[model samples]
Target: MNFNGPLETSALRQVEICDSKLTDQLRLNAIERSRMMDSPNEEVFDRLAFLAAKFLQVPLTIVSIVGDKKQFFKAAHGLPSPYDVSREIPIEDSICRYTLQNEPIIADDATKHELLKHHPTIGPWGIGAFIAIPMLTHDGQVLGAFCAVDTKAKPWTEDDILMLKELTASVMREIHLREKISELEDESQLRDKFVAAISHDLRNPLNVAKMGAQLLSDMDGDEEERADISRVICENVDRADKMIQDLLTASRLKAGDKMPLEVTFGDLSALLHSTVESLQKGHRRAFHFESEKTIDGHWDFDRVRRVVENFSGNAVKYGDESKPIRISVEDHPESARISVHNYGPSIPSDEIDNLFNLFKRAQSARDSKHLGWGVGLTVARSLAEEMGGRIEVESTEEKGTIFSLHLPKVKPSLH
Candidate 1:
């Protein structure tokens, strides 16, 4: 997934590209890592812009990060009314984007300059003279621009351009420092979450198994009761073991490792029908199956079964029990889709993307009377991608929730 930066603006296609770097994903990632776009103006950056304006004698100066949709003003000194208040403008209207070519833009008279003359905001904003210095990281990815603008046409001397360049370096220093700090904080939070999730989620099943064993040892029940307790103990032990395996898998996948898969020919339709039948025996919720007679594919059987069970388990836990949970398999030319759908409260739009993240549970899941470690979806996504597939989800009040896995018919590569 791409980083949708904070600016709520239009698409990057609106901007005329003079440099391919303007659309480079790595460059955009650097900008996102900086975390400077749409952020509150810091005194340190405001001071730099102020000093640039005063030293260069330009009425307006800005420190901006040019994003795909819009240009965000980290600092705007002496900027006009609405733009200063909003701190951003559509990418099509931004003259600062020209600096992404890794060169300083010096337009003495923008109205006559071939490149600046056609931009709509150039005339209305009374930008007669402007100089933009590209803010480049140490690795030479241009983030955006540090520019000085004047209402009246004027020539920039060498000394003035040199000073502005120095200040641009200062801007990049601050951005890089902030990026490092954010990375460190994220690492710390990841460690904390790992500790918390293991300690909390693993305790429930372990305690259940321990209690069942203790009850059996006490010999307070008859033979039938002892057998029941033994079965419960085994089930709880299996549950705990599965949780540990999922935790390890999620951790490895999160660290950018591909999961190992055992590929074999199988019938997806048969897989779903059998899995759903077994689930129906265990769960009170009604299970309905629909599919062609057979949907053949080369894929990992155990991983696919794991995903089916997870999706169906979620449906049983959260869906309205009165309504039947539907499981279906559809065969396409290049791929096959297995969907598990249930009627229940819909997932909120804001929380949908987060559902696949480690330890991220939907609001409905948190509010429901069900217990989950929230690692299932994360591991499911990794397994699907490793098998050259993806998971798609849709939820609405009228349509209910649907979780579908799209798998390639033929294996993409050896695991």
Candidate 2:
């Protein structure tokens, strides 16, 4: 009768701590709204949920959103109606309520539970086995549940749980991005409407600031003051330029217009040394390079350098500033390898899978002083793949972190 034993424990562990009453209310409201939406719609979300359930080979799948009143089925498979017969199950009895509390996929054999054994859906419909995963927004918002049910008892593997969770997370990300795009669209429209008004109002003030700074530089009252003014102007201009570049880069990347690779045989050691030297000048971190053997490999030198720079910069920014960043290169007859090692806090095991994902960052990175847009690793990995190489990271809380790049050694064609 106790199907809740392992299921409840697994689900409870994944629960995110939320103290804000307003946030809780808003989340519940969103769930309710999502649940009311019907299936087989034009919306991409419905198709995604349906595909996820089908791909997982589940008999009954429901995109269930948990609200304060009831668990609503936004999309349902192997069910006659869009809405469940019971609009609201007591939160205590709701399996998805458990999912909302935990991060893992909650799978239970309901045949053993006296409560679920006699339940309306399980008893009459012959639906006993249940599996549910929490669908989460990028900012860690538990939006709803993705679940599958069957009449027969089935054993669930850890891989099954992880795969379902990953699928649900992917769906949630797409939904979140769509919502963001909608919001941005509205903002863009409003900006267009008031473009002339805002521009006219701000242009004079900005021009005055610029002219005043220039006048101060020409006056040369005090050398230090002149330098300070010039620095402020330059810094502001640089900030603006960076913002523009970021926007352009994002657009290009989304459009799959990243720089193309032109692989050629080159000395990786020289390129790595140059990168280290350049980084050392900007960041006051000791950079050490070592090579077990000289390597001439076929690769996009610029792309490889970018990867090295990214890792090195990350080490200097996130690792212990006083500790040295070490670069090592090794070459085999068939392959070449490069590793960047830094003495930093280990990345959590849970985050390793997401490290290379676009816009994904470790929790430690969020809490630390290191600032980034979280796309560096993703870009590096892509570049590596383009050059027929792979990048991997190894880390431990005690030992530190090492990022390694492996590439195939190119052999010259006989003429």
Candidate 3:
């Protein structure tokens, strides 16, 4: 009821005569944090207060977390006069700081105990007797206290602390259980999304192949036209197979599969020429390649080919169709680099970091009409890293976008 702002700790002490009476602000902050990690369930906390109120025979049982400037009532059984078990009380007007900072308290009468007699709540709320146990985490952070209070003077026993301690354990157990359940539920949702993505990605190419097959069957054309139809069918089939292979490769990667040096070694120049030819045949774009005559590498040719195809495909998809997409291979003693460049809208620097993650697409690509499942770069990065190589990207308003893949020029020995 109309909780005011920042009730200065001045109410607790006057002109700071002695410092030992100070509250443990650190422990109080810890208490605030421990409560924030879990969702507050009134029913769960109410049960604690109910149990405490019944066993201790106190009219008021509150599960309190001491905050920076106020005491939060997480759960309460019976509190009166402008309050119940659920209200914020300024720390300066609260007496929780005593037991919360030190050992548990068993105040038989507030008037007798010097520490709590002058407390703002003592005369107003009639807090005659107080008993609280610190609700602690495994690492020993005092979250708050479970306490019982009565209006008339009373006595608290050792057995009361034990009972309250057991109850604190019960409440903490529920908190831990709820937190773990939330994590598992979140993970299950992510798994479902992964399955949906794989299904959609695989289905797209399969649908194209099926349509190509249907068109082929209805054909009554010359050899050239028939060959073109066959090419369409073949390209679709290859695309479908590529999607499946990406899934397979991703699984292997997850399972710790590695590519040996021998597997990656091949003719670098020839692969670039062939990959570009295959891509250009299907797309309405010009492809240009420049490379050393006799390039050698101990790199996974197949993996590199996937990266090349993805990079070149992105170029054609994003670049000016009237202009040419260029592929350049530079050979060095230590390594060889393949760069795919396209004239297109630039990608922002912040977006490049997450570009290779599975299911993550650059904002530029998402905004464009060209759509993809966003796994091609994922495969590319995996393959490159496994082969002891790296992939890099650069984009600008002037030169457009360029993706460069670096691989060892010479193959490593198995031994």
- Candidate with top lDDT is 1
Kindly list the per-residue Cα lDDT of model 3 for residues 47-121, writing each as its tens digit.
Answer: 888998999888998877755566777888886756553476776765554554436656888666646655556
**TM-score of each model, paired residue for residue:** 0.71, 0.50, 0.55
**TM-score-best of 1 and 3:** 1
Q: Name model 3 segments beyond 4 Å from true.
A: 1-201, 218-221, 259-266, 320-322, 412-415
Error of 3 at 346 (Å): 3.0
| lDDT score at residue 18, model 3, on the 0-100 scale | 19
Cα miss at 329, model 3 (Å)? 1.5
Q: Least lDDT summed over 10 consecutive residues: which range in candidate 2? A: 13-22
Global lDDT of model 3: 0.73
Which residue pairs show collisions in model 3? 264-299, 264-300
- TM-score, candidate number 2: 0.50
For candidate 2, write residues 270-345 as lDDT tens digits. 8888878876755657999998756787767877887787788678778877789999998888888899999878
Tens digit of lDDT per residue, candidate 1, span 40-90? 978999999999999999999999998878899999789888988899988
Can you tell me which runs of candidate 2 are displaced by over 4 Å? 1-250, 411-415
